[model samples]
Target: MEIYNDHKKLFTAALCLFLLLTFFVAIGPAFTSQNNNAPLPGSKPLSSLQTEGKAVFIAEGCVACHTQQVRNVEMDKVWGPRPNVAADYANITRTDVWRNTATLMGSERTGPDLTNIGTRQPGDDWHYLHLFNPRSVVSQSVMPSYEWLFDIKDYAWPNDVVVNVPDDFKKGISGKIVASHKAMALVAYLKSLKEVTLPDGKPVPLFLYGKTAAEKAGGATSKGAGTKSGPDGEALYATNCQSCHQGNGEGLVGAFPALKGSKVVLDDNAELQVTIIMKGYNGRVSEGYGEMPPVGTNNNLKPEEVAAIVNHERSSWGNNSKKVTVDDVKKIIASFDKPASVAAKK
Candidate 1:
């Protein structure tokens, strides 16, 4: 009884309780979340370029100003479709044995949550310009320039990646500002930060409060009643195309090509457009438009979804073209072997 009442014994007991509460009660569930065990449905491992860029991002302390996390608060709706869940970041792997900077879910919104940047503002030119001079694209931006990642080459080589800067932002620097390999890698990493949609029936953080049950119940309506009205095309475009190509199909100048009144878009035959979307476009092919990294192959876009995007692009922006069906897109996709012949057709 004396030992139990002693100050030393009581102090030891309190210390043990504190440790248990800290480790087990407060922190244990976070480490044991089920979502951490598996990658989200559309999650993919970062490529070599993206990995290097991630290192630059961390090395530069980008996380100090920007956050990768989207909270469940109504104010955070601008960041992503839904508040972030553990599954959203499940696929991020450690950079190496010594570094584990893969999970860069920052807590500050000094910039913005980059969770869906790939689907929001995904153009090499725009990213480069933003890095070179933040105010060029966003007048209110306070972010510093990462000009060291770029090179002001006297003349660009045939295969060099050039950063297209507007005349106003250009400070009379005599040559083209070509992006170094590091800049490309950093852009790749930023572009790879898109959010993968949670699988059906999975519960997401409730940004729309008091509507969880209603949302689950309304899932049936998302199926659509018929073919033309189906959510596939518009939904797919919103997910894959809307970022670089603006919501109105008028893409950013010097960055992404405009779909409105574009010769390729207005062409009766959809083969070339389909091919470009599937295989990607090299910037060297055109003088103005920047390189469009292949969207279909890496993203695993299905034939039907590609067709949907094609139809959406063609039909929108005052374009009066016949709606190309999935069957039509499938034929073009199948003819990948005969590129010379496929591209030859007008």
Candidate 2:
């Protein structure tokens, strides 16, 4: 009874209670979560270079401006095909033994969400140029140039990776731009950020408030929702092709070739257009424009999604051409068992 009445004893008892609660409520849950949340099915661990690049991503304060999450909202639809889920981030590993950046869900969206950037713009050249100088690709971008990641070489060695910077952004530097090892690693990290597919039969949480942009585009979800229509071509183009092709379909002068009134775009042979979208086209790489990536394969873009994109391109930018159906695009995808790699095609 005397001990209970003592101030020191009471204070000690209160402190013990607080610690007990903390252990049970916070610490216990953390350990349990670690045990429960294994990496989602089919999630790939980051490669060594990508892990190094992730450290670079954190070191450069990229997290301050950019985000990795896509919130479940109608507006955020522009950032990704579907809203982000816990499973999407279940595979995050520590940056190193010394420190863990944890998941780079980020603090805010000062730039854009990088959830599906790998799928959205898979072009290696585009990423390289953008990293070196944001304004090179996006004229109105406010991102500072990371020119330190590159070097100006009088002539690149055969094995060296030469960056074909646009003349205007080159600032009269006479040498070809060679990417440093760190730069290559950083680009590899960015390219490896593809969206993982959910296992079959799992119901997706629909984005709140309205019909999806895909729905508006006369398309449905990639998961086979609203299969009566194709996916939204305009949205898909904006996500996957707009950076290189530009919003108006007129590509960057001297960098990317213009798609407005393009002969291939206007051609009746939708097969060529579909093949280019799926397998990528480098036929014009010799003309200074860079090679396109196999966006469809990389992103796992479905037949309906590909058709929708083709339709949007064929109809947009004052170019009117035949629009292929989902079935047509499916046939095109099936025909090419082998990759139409830029090296092989060129």
TM-score, each model? 0.59, 0.79
lDDT of 1 by residue, 1-346 (tens): 7758799998898899999999887688768764457787779999988889998998889988888888888778767778887666777777789867658777677787788887665557779888987766665678888999999989899888887776677788778899898888999999998878778997766785444766545543211112633335666776676656767787666666788888878888888888888877774446766677667765667886787778777777797676677788888888877765575553
Q: Write the per-residue lDDT of candidate 2 for residues 1-346, one digit (tens) a residue.
A: 8868899999998999999999999999998988787666888999999998887887788888988888988888777768888778878867679877658888788788888887777788998889878987777888888899898888889888788787778878888899998888888888888777777887776888867666577745432122455465777787778777788998876568877999888989777777777777788777777888888877778887888788788888898887777888777777676586333453
Count of backbone collisions within predicted model 1: 0
Candidate 1's error at 91, in angstroms? 7.0
Candidate achieving the largest lDDT: 2
Show the colliding residue pairs in model 1: none
Using TM-score, give the best candidate's number.
Answer: 2
Instruction: Give candidate 2 regions above 4 Å deviation.
Output: 1-27, 212-235, 284-288, 299-305, 315-327, 337-346
How many pairs of residues collide in model 2?
1
Candidate 1 lands at a TM-score of 0.59
